[model samples]
Target: MELGVNIWSFIDRILCWRQPCACCGAPGRALLCPGCLADLPRLDNPCRRCAEPLPAGATPLCPRCLGPRPPAFARVHALFAYAPPVDRLITGLKYHGRWEAARLLGSLLGEALAGADPLPDILVPVPLHPRRLRRRGYNQALELARHAAARAGLPLEAGRCRRVRHGPPQAGQDAAARRRAVRDAFAVDGRVDGLHVGLVDDVVTTAATVNELARVLRRAGAREVSVWCAARAGRTSGT
Candidate 1:
């Protein structure tokens, strides 16, 4: 069962690459087969502020984001839910040395925003801690940002934001724990006054990392900061 699931998931992720449709086994050309693309879980009714999946017939803002303390970032745009093929693609890019997955994910994000207006002035890929960077040999976020920025014809500003503190992986942490773990982990090295910046990443779980980085950017004079991620884990109540 597990192996079948993994194989299917792998096929689903082919939507972002120029390969045969994993689902229909068609000629490889586009990112995904139409049938498979239609099967992917898309977040249509997302929170206006944070882009969390909204409940059926719920308001634009999630309860957690509607609480007194608003998020630092202006908005979030994610392509898919953090499940199945999407999750597999992210994991493959980050852990399995799959650079093609990064490029494909980034391209998908770019295409999603093709017709949108008021695009970001700069794209900043979330930074990795020096230790982690050495271990991974590359920051997955940076690779994605490069592709997204190039496709969108936007400036890609990397290395301006640095991760100063290395925290434990956020895989098992709850909302509060995730917040605490990332709190003070980032620092802005240059000015971004009045700039509309977009922060790119592979996945958003609790959104703790992007929030902390957005806070830093705001403090450094950024006028706006938005998040662009490939997937979001799930919705969270206002906490």
Candidate 2:
């Protein structure tokens, strides 16, 4: 089994080598070439809680998500600031079924989480409604979460939670409407009590979905819920 796995890995590497970079069409071992990778919009001095870009020397939590009442998740870990090439990669994998983009993005997310002191007990891909799951054939979040779990040496507990409600695509909804659509959309099944759970998703725009999911996990006695997404979209329409 080990030898067969190694052979397949070698073959996969060869195949990846032949394909051009998804961003700039550069020939390379990685999905995105170094030049395009460098050009990707990385979050700079972001608010620790929401991963939104903050003014220099601003507080850890953004004003919009901060208040007397604490937020659902502890913090968000995002690689990019949702723009240009990063957006293309997300859209490609999510809408166009580009598995290579998912793998590359997940690997980067794993690398970022590698140094976490107290790693999450399990990684949970945000669930998709049964209708959407059937239509899409596969959940992009699950694909990315599987790759990230392997890289981070963690277990993926995708079955622990489920989406019970189906709503319209969040892309066209404002923040308030998004919240309403996602309310009570998720339910935890298996043991999650007191466990540190990490919610994995591709992009976090208004964060309504993750917030609602986190609320469910917390009610089920989860110790902490941290969101991990490939990109964090800016608050404004165009940033």
TM-scores for the candidates: 0.86, 0.93
Top TM-score prediction, candidate number: 2
In model 2, how large is the Cα lDDT of residue 202?
A: 93
lDDT of 1 by residue, 1-239 (tens): 89996896587566445677644667665545677767777876888888887778998898879999889999888988887677777888899877667777888777765544668888899999999999999999998887788678788989889999999887777888889989899999879999988999988877889999999999999999999999887734222
- Looking at model 1, residue 53 earns an lDDT score of 76
Candidate 1, which segments miss by more than 4 Å at Cα? 1-18, 22-25, 235-239
lDDT of 2 by residue, 23-107 (tens): 7787788888888888898888888788878888888788877877556998888989888788888888888899889889998
Candidate 2 regions with alpha-carbon error over 4 angstroms: none
Question: Largest lDDT belongs to which candidate?
Answer: 2
Model 1 residue 78 CA deviation (Å) reads 0.6
Question: Candidate 1: how many backbone clashes?
Answer: 4
**Total clashing residue pairs per candidate?**
4, 0
In candidate 1, the residue pairs with backbone N, CA or C atoms under 3 Å apart (3 or more residues apart, or in different chains) clash, namely 15-31, 15-32, 19-28, 64-238
